[model samples]
Target: MPKLWNETIDAHREQVREAIVNVTSTLVFEQGLRAVTMSQIAEHAGIGRATLYKYFPDVETILRTWHARQIDSHISELTQVRAGAGSPGERLDAVLASYAHIAHQTGSHDRELVKFLHPDERIVNAQNQLREIVRQLIEEGATAGELRDDVDPAELANYCLHALSGAAELTTAEAIARLVALTAAGLRPPQS
Candidate 1:
């Protein structure tokens, strides 16, 4: 019984997990993704290669895990942005504000995420989901007559997503402004 309790606690040791994640994030940020290896991660994580394997099977696993966490966070933020009451345009601006914050936080973690993105199928799916989220918001905005009807919402969303991602290079304030302007331009109702 004591061993079982200990085992479970050890499994959930947040410090260890964070140490691994931080080490890897830092490595990728500084050296780019290709520079890091499982052996290096194991070394930086202060664990043996075999031990690290017990936690994550491969480098791709760790990368996917980190990317998934960011995606999950983006989803949560979107949920809040959607829940808040505002005009469709206003809500999109609000959501983009939140996204800018996320993108700029942690030494531009989002930028690092962009840099490390692998050409994997899963990464493509993640990008699609983000685009879809943007598209849906545009659609809702258009339905509210807060957006133009001429452009396809899906295409607009995809374009805005790329635009916002490109703005990740800017300061948070700059990114927010850019996002606001871009979204407003995309969503502004047709001239009467």
Candidate 2:
């Protein structure tokens, strides 16, 4: 096949795969994970069962792929937020606020779906990346005399992550912001 023809074929395959993923995600979200089926996804995606199987072997694979895509998008968003021009403390605040907002939104998802998605290695890797981002910011803040120097950055990063995890339970944006503020405050150096 010609180069353009090959590229077109690849693009079309990607589009079909994305459509399948979107349909599967919507069905799982609206009908519950246990209620969704591979045939349902194929019909909803407007693809035949055989075609769908060519893209994914089962419902679990599709859901895992969808979750991985979501995680990648989140990591990219956080990376951009961290890269924004600001002082170390300001950047940290922005990243934490953004992260808390994401947690708040995701908290509304079905409990079973969240539980099902939590055990994947992709989630673990994404979490590690998040921790590293926060740790670097904490180190920068400490060097700038903004955050406390009394604790290791790794320890403080763990504290920040654990404290901010509560944002997932918050019902309001105000509450999430409050949680972020409290977590950020905990990183400040003690007053003389």
Candidate 3:
């Protein structure tokens, strides 16, 4: 096959795979995970069962892929927020706020669905990525005198993640913001 044809085929395959993932996610979200079947997903995705099998062996595989995609998207969004033009303190605030918002939204998902998705290694890797991002920001802030130097950056990073994880239980944007503010406050240097 010509190079252009090969690239086109690859792009088409990716689009089909993404479509299947999206359809599976919608079915799982709207119909509940247990109620969603592979046949239903294949039909809803407009692909034959055989084609769906080529992409995913079972409903669980499809759901896992969808969850992995969501994790990637969330990480990418936070990376952008961290990279946005701002002072280190301001960037840190933005990143924390973005992360808290995601946690708050995810908290509303069905408990069963959350449980199903939470055990994957991808979640652990994503968390480690999130920690690294926050750690780098903390180091920047500490060096800039915006955050306390008394605490190690890695320790502060862990503290920030654990503190903000509580945002999952928060009910309102105001509450989440308050939580983020309190977490940020803990990072601030003490006055003489």
lDDT of 1 at 119: 60
- Alpha carbon lDDT of residue 192, candidate 1? 67
Instruction: Determine the C-alpha RMSD for candidate 3 after optimal superposition of all C-alphas.
Output: 1.5
| Candidate 3 residue-wise lDDT, 41-100, digit = tens | 889989899999998999888888889988999999999999999889999999999999
lDDT of 2: 0.92
Which regions of candidate 2 fall more than 4 Å away from where they truly are?
A: none
| Each candidate: RMSD | 3.6, 0.9, 1.5
Clashing pairs in 2: none
Off by over 4 Å in 3: none
Candidate 2 per-residue lDDT over residues 66-113, each given as its tens digit: 999999999999999999998888899988988888887788888999
lDDT computed for candidate 3: 0.92
Error of 2 at 71 (Å): 0.9
Best by TM-score: 2
Supply candidate 2's per-residue lDDT for 111. Answer: 95
Better of 1 and 3 by lDDT: 3
